[model samples]
Target: MNPLQKRCLILGASTRAAAQSALYAGYHPVCADLFADTDLCTIAERLPLQNYPDNLVEQATSISPISWMYTGALENSPEIIQAISKHHVLWGNNAEVVQAVRNPQKLYQVLKKHDLTALHLREFNHPPPANSRWMLKPKRSAGGREVTVWNREAESYYAESHNKDKLSTDYYFQQRAEGKNYSALYLASATQTVLIGLSAQLVGCHWLNADNFTWCGNVAPVLFSHQPEKHQKLAIQAEKAGNVIAKEFGLRGLFGIDFILETPFLPSSFPQLFPLEVNPRYVASVELFERAFDVSLLKWHIAACESFEQSQQEEFVTTENYSANFSAKAIQGKAILYANCTFTFPLTIERMPNCADIPSYGRLIQKNEPICTVFATGKTIESCQKDLQERSDEIYDALKIKE
Candidate 1:
């Protein structure tokens, strides 16, 4: 596929979801991930620029132009990303925007400055305290890989790895707050940024009934019947963060932000809203929600990528039909771990407009990867969540990972 004709450049581990973005945008996708898959139609490019750590501008010159580029999990620093973003053909999002949300330490500081309450955080490279429980996180990572709560002993092992990685002893520590996790996506250009899509995200909820805290898969258009105020607060907090970030970093293009709601004051009630972490790029679940909502988030993202200076209050340019749907995933094991597990279970998939006799809109049936990605739309958020769960549960229970 020709690079110039493409709408976006996708990185990271998920292909199905990435492909969906490409399809929705009506542009080709130039994929550059750490894996190899034939199903990804576009020509693959280098995963990461080897010699250009600081000067990504030069490295990006190696690839062809894209209407917009959505790449890997961003790091804590934006300088590196800015270097590369300059060379892109389209004016998609730059690196500084991503860096703002990537670093827990930096993000907390800014949130505090903005009069927003964020997670209780601390960063350390050396030993953890004896009685405290904490989560050990990679300075830059995604998909909950190596992000887990560590007891005193577990903290020691992670600290050893951190030392090997040349990590700072005072990396980041946060008082783990209990709350619902949700995300919103926005677009920005050099002069303005706009909120294109608002779907409640689902993650880090597996700990509710687990022996230890486990990161769960994400679903969209939240179904948390328990928390309304917290959810709204988090959304407002996200807008504030984006406002500050767009001005501070001169951020442009497509970006996503994730936050946790905090409210321990009332056990039976939802917790208060608190911004936990921010993701400054396109998120994982955009694929499923876009399908259900009948909106083209990809196009608006492209339009915004053309300019990064847009503000949150700018005129709306995106389109959406419905407000809810569910796309769930399950880690049945490596057997079903083909690609990055775009859609796992609990999805009510349907055939696309023209896909007849197709299995769930001609979804993949080969066990070599995911059996299929289920998608269902509903009139209400609850209806969407309920149908999503029913569909996702049925598929999850029926499929046995063929190990």
Candidate 2:
């Protein structure tokens, strides 16, 4: 380690990009996460975490005296964030803000007061509407991992699992909204916020063989309509809602808001956008924004939280210009490659283009295990989707393991 280089520790379910971003900002990144992929290992010091929150404090203490930041699932566990704060400097929101935004009832009330549309949610005690699909979402969770449709038949099934306790208090049923999923990413300081980018979320992709509501990836610079005017209006609406949430919650650093666009074609229609929840932390779509906009939101995220002397803040451009630029430029997307069946890691990969999150060689991957991430870009969303599909197909073919 260079004596002069600042050291930063990144903790999350996956810290690959956070580590990379730290390095980009000239900091030595130390990472602890579930998968210590080869690419991540190449650039940063990797610490394999057996169990989170329980073991995080000990592991973090082992590498003491370094500032830390969390990426994905850790944001959902404010207690863990608080524990880490006792030993290290946290580079993002404090535990209080995390707790505030994660409280579904409070969040819903706040957003509702601001006229932001959100799904009708209720505690588990409330009976679900008959014949209507409702999703059971775990509080303090991310990556859509245990989120599933609610039903009486699944009660016994859940009762048998270790998550039975979580069902009591940390879970609730939400009325599902019909629409295309979207997310608004932004950077915030104490006083103001800036819209970083927008993404069309990839949910439950058939090619990925993921469950319904499972987050696959994102396509940045989302086009809501063919007409440029409506597209800008939709962007403005989403951004306005995001800014309100950020300011209302006093959210600082890089945060993302998940939403559903019920009417993508008719952007001018009332209640076209319904915000689902606020992820007051670094999200999966940050990588997509960095790729599409040729900007480093992560760098600014750190700067926004800390008192770093950053040169030239990221400009907040007009929504019209933002939408027009996205329409004119290329569209980029990423796909999380999941294993269809249990198999040993391949000794060699063939022509696997734009792949990331690679598991270690000789490691056995179980069914539905996320093997890696694949990325692609093109002139349009459809073409980008096709390109990413092709790349994913090439990887599966090379692996040659059927579902």
lDDT of each: 0.50, 0.77
Candidate 1 per-residue lDDT, tens place, 1-403, comes to 5545544555444444555576766766655543333334333334453332343454455666644355545344455455555655543455644655566777777777878766666556444564545566666655555555657665566558545554455245566665555556666555545544345543432211111333333445553447667556555665676677666666665666666555477667545556656566666656545654556666666665553344432543332311222232221101012222333332233321211111333244443333433444565555655554555455444443322
1-403: candidate 2 lDDT, tens digit per residue: 6677788998888889778777767788899888888889988987767875578878988876767889888877788889889889878888999989888888888877888777788897674753447778888667777887776666655667785665677788788777788888887875567776678888888788677778888888776457777677777887788788888788988888888878545655654778777888888887777667665666677767876432333343333223334433468898887888899988666235588888888989998778889999887788888888888888888899745
Give stretches of model 1 more than 4 Å off.
Answer: 1-8, 36-39, 42-68, 74-87, 126-133, 156-171, 189-200, 204-216, 223-234, 267-270, 307-399
Candidate that would win on lDDT: 2
Backbone clash numbers for all candidates listed: 44, 0
| lDDT (C-alpha) at residue 257 in model 2 | 85
**Which candidate number would show the highest TM-score if scored against the true structure?**
2
Q: How accurate is candidate 2 locally (lDDT)?
A: 0.77
Q: Kindly report which residue stretches of model 2 are placed more than 4 angstroms away from their true locations once superposed.
A: 1-4, 151-166, 264-271, 308-329
Q: lDDT score of model 1?
A: 0.50
Task: Give the lowest summed-lDDT range of ten residues in model 1.
Answer: 330-339
